[model samples]
Target: MRIGLFVACITDSLYPATARATVRVLERLGHTVVYPAAQTCCGQVHYTSGYRREAASLAGRFADVFSGCELVVTPSASCAAMVRTGYPRLAAREPRAADAPRVLELSEFLVDVAGVTDVGAHFPHRVTYHPTCHALRSLDVGDRPLRLLRAVRGLELAELPAADECCGFGTTFAWKNADTSVAIVADKIRHIGATGADVVCALDDACLTQIDGALSRLRGGVRALHLAEILAAGDPAGDR
Candidate 1:
């Protein structure tokens, strides 16, 4: 399948590895990935922080840039969730000429479009899952990620407590409300620590950053990485 890779601003700048891993995972599964050069921010940061007008304009640009692709896929569930859920709401407020539901998060696009239940990757660690709020609530992706993960060879998936709760990073929420953010993440860290997992994995890179921050600050011995990074390990290109 020919897929359009929607490399959001955060992944392109802060976490390029997630973007590269996304390409690796798609290519490993025999799909062609086309990165639209005009792609920019998903405006999730703006939208979530009460910048509706700016968010709507950015959403239009997002749809316009990737309109040619048969299917649009993004690794950051935060960005994808913004496009899927936030865009529709913003689109309705505007003229609605640019609204399109073809865009999908990596979790949904992989399982739904590619008909790929298994991507043939392996991670032999006791890993825990953290479902970032956007991926779980906005994108509504639960089993989609787990289904692919369960197929990874030698991967011991541990059940994390309160998997559906946010990691306290809703764009600027972490920085704006530092104390509350730290507190929420502290609770999450305790849950993952209880699981005794070597690392915590999730689809959204934003959550990884948030959770990793709290884990590091609290001195918890756990690491966080995007789900694509885990799956891309199976690719012959080598892990990033």
Candidate 2:
């Protein structure tokens, strides 16, 4: 399968390894992973921050760059959801610029398109899951990633209390209201600590950054790991 990787701005800049792992996982699956270097922000930040006109401009650029790919895959679920769910909303407002390709989150492509039951990967750690907002409500990718994670060899999947709840990081939602953000994140940290998982895995970097930062601040001590990093851990012999 020829797959185009849309390494979204956040992952491309702040979390490059997540983007790297996305490639590694696909390449290991015997697929051609193409990095669309022309990709940039999905205009989500602008739109959500009340700059609709600017958002339309940026979303147009993203559509132009993403048009060529047959199947676009991205690591960050929020960006993917922005392109999938949010871009269409922007298009409705600015009908002149709506000829964009739809984007798919990694979990969506893996489960629906790739028809993968068990990706041959292994990690022997006890982990809890955090379902990112866009990944959950926006993209509607519920338990697809969890289903895959549960299949990994030697992994112990611990149920996250209020697993589907937001981790208080709504991409600037935290930055704007620091007090509320910290308060909400504090609750998430307590829930995570009670589970006693060594790691908390999710598909969104924003939530990971927010919750993991609180973990560090409160010294809760559970590390946040991206699902792509775990997916990249397949055995060399193709027998994970």
Candidate 3:
């Protein structure tokens, strides 16, 4: 399958390695991955922030950029959720509204579409997964990530306490409600600490950033790793 990689704005700018890792994993599986350079923000930020007109414009751009691909995949679950769930609402009047259904989260595409759980990854560290709100509730990517993690050669998957709770990175929610965001994230950090995992893994970089920042401020040893990075761990040719 020719997979068009939708590198979300955050991943494209802040976490390019995550995007690279995603490509490596997909290529290793014999699928051709194409990066649509014209792709930009999925308008998730705009849509969630109530800039409906701007969000709709970007949604149309997204649809146009990947219109030729058979399937579109992105490493960030939040962006995938936005394109799949939010685009329909934001671009209701646009002709590209039908494009929303073609976008898939990394885990969803890997486990469901590609029909592969084990991506031949090896990471010999204790890791706990944080199911970001979008991936958990919006995308409903239940257990797909876990199944992939479980198949890793040397990974020790620890159960995170209160695993389903939000990490408090609800896009603009963090800035608008700083105190509440901090408190919620504090609880998430406490639960992560309880897990005794050295690394926290998730499909969403936004959530990982929030958790990772708290871990750094608290001087905790836990570090955040995107699932794609973990899956690309053992690839000799892939970026570390």
Candidate 4:
């Protein structure tokens, strides 16, 4: 399958490895991954921030960029949810509205569309997964990520406490509601610490960033890693 890689803004700028790992895993599966340079933000922030017109413009551009691909995959669940759910709400009458159903989160694409869970990955670490709100509620990608993680050769999957709780990174919500965001993230960090996991993995880098910041402030040893990064580890070619 020819898959169009929608490297969301956060993955492109802050977590490029996530994008590379996504490509690595897809290519490992013998699928052609195409990067459309024209692709930008899925208009999620704009849409959530009450800029419907601006969000619609971006959604239109997103559709044009990946219109030719058979499938569109993104590592960030928030971005995938934005394209899948937010785009239609932002511009139902626009041509880009038709592209909503074509977008898939990485785990969804792997487990549902690609029909494969074992991506031939290996990682020797005690890891806990945080289901981003967008992945859990918006995309309903329950257990697909965990399924893939379980299939990894050397990964020790630890169940996170209160796994369904939000990480307090509601995009701009962090800026507008700093105190509440900090308190929520503090609780999240406490749960992560209780797991004694070496790494915290999630489908959204934005959430990971929020968690990582708290970990750094507390001088915690735990590392925040994207799901793609964890899967990208132990590549036979040592490319990752």
Candidate 5:
């Protein structure tokens, strides 16, 4: 099975390790991974920010790049949501653009497409998962991530308190409504602290950055990790 990795902007720039982990997990499962160098932002920010024309242009670009790939996989749930949902609306006037290639979030691709849950990963850590807004409501990835985590050899999966609550990243909402964003994440941080897990994991880097930053400021000791990173883990000690 050949897979094309859509390393979304945030993941490509700030969380390259997540991209690499994604490749590692897929290759470990015996799938070939291809990276399209022409790939760029999915225009989610532009569309969500109300720049329809610019967003449409980017949507067309995205369609051009990955339309021929066997399958597109991304680590970011929000980006997948944008390509799957947002792109069609943005490219409605352009018939060709509306037929953009199918894209799946990593968890969905692994569970639904590949039909495999246990990828033979080993990670010795007490971990809790924070399902991002796009992953939970937008993408509705459900228990796929948890299923993979539960299969990890040495990982102890702890249930997160108020697990469905948004981490307050909300894409541009984090900056546009700074005070409200901080307040929401403060509550999220408190709930995470109660879990007593060594690490918190999520599908989107945006949410992880939000939760991880808050945890770091207070030296909360709980590290934020991406789902792919955990699934890619082979070391008993794991990557710190």
Candidate 6:
């Protein structure tokens, strides 16, 4: 399948490794991955920030960028959720923006669309998965990430305590509600530390950033990894 990779702004800027890992994993699966130069934000930040006009315009641009692709996949579950759920509503009144590309989060495309569990990944360390709020509640990508991790060679999957809880990085919510966000992620970090895992994995970079901040400041010793980065392990090109 020729899949268009919608590298979200966060992944493109802060976590370029995740985007590279995504490409590595997809190509390893014998799929042709294409990156459309015109692709931009999925309008998630603006929509959630109550700037509907700006959000709708970006949503239309997003649709136009990947218009011809059969399937659009993104590493960030947060952005994927926005594209699939937010775009239609934002573009409801525009005839040109009526159709949006079929957008799927990486795990969704791998497990449901590609019909593969193991991407031949190898990581010799104990790892726990923290399902981001978008992945858990918005996208409802239940257990797909875990299923893939379970199939990894030499990787141990530990269940995170209160795994369904938010990491408190709801985009602007983290900045706007500093105290509450800190408290929520404090609990999340505590749970992550309890697992005794070397790495904590999630589908979205936003949550990883939130979790990583606490883990770093507290010196919790647990590293945050995007699912694609973990799955890209043991490749001939090596993990990014």
Q: At residue 126, give the lDDT of candidate 6.
A: 98
Alpha carbon lDDT of residue 66, candidate 6? 87
For candidate 1, lDDT tens digit of each residue in 126-147?
8888888877877788788888
Predicted model with the maximum TM-score: 6
Model 4 ranges with Cα > 4 A deviation: 99-101, 237-240
Model 6 / residue 56 / CA error / Å: 0.5
> For candidate 4, lDDT tens digit of each residue in 56-135?
88888888888788788889899888887777676665666666538888999999988998988888889999999999
* Whole-model lDDT per candidate: 0.81, 0.81, 0.89, 0.88, 0.90, 0.90
Q: Write the per-residue lDDT of candidate 3 for residues 9-102, one digit (tens) a residue.
A: 7788799999999999999999999987787788889988888888888888888888888788899888888877887786566657567538
- Give the 10-residue window scoring lowest on summed lDDT in candidate 6: 90-99
lDDT of 2 by residue, 10-95 (tens): 67778887887887777777889877677777888888999989888888887777677677888888888777667778887766
Q: Give model 6's clash tally.
A: 0
Error of 3 at 21 (Å): 0.4
List the candidate numbers ranked by lDDT, top first.
Answer: 5, 6, 3, 4, 1, 2
Of candidates 6 and 1, the better by TM-score: 6
> What would the per-residue lDDT of candidate 6 be over residues 55-145, giving only the tens digit for each residue?
8888888878888898899998999899878877876654445577888999999999999999999999999999988899889999999
The residue pairs in collision within model 5 are: none
CA RMSD of each candidate after superposition: 1.7, 2.3, 1.2, 1.5, 1.5, 1.0
Model 3 Cα shift for residue 230 (angstroms): 0.3
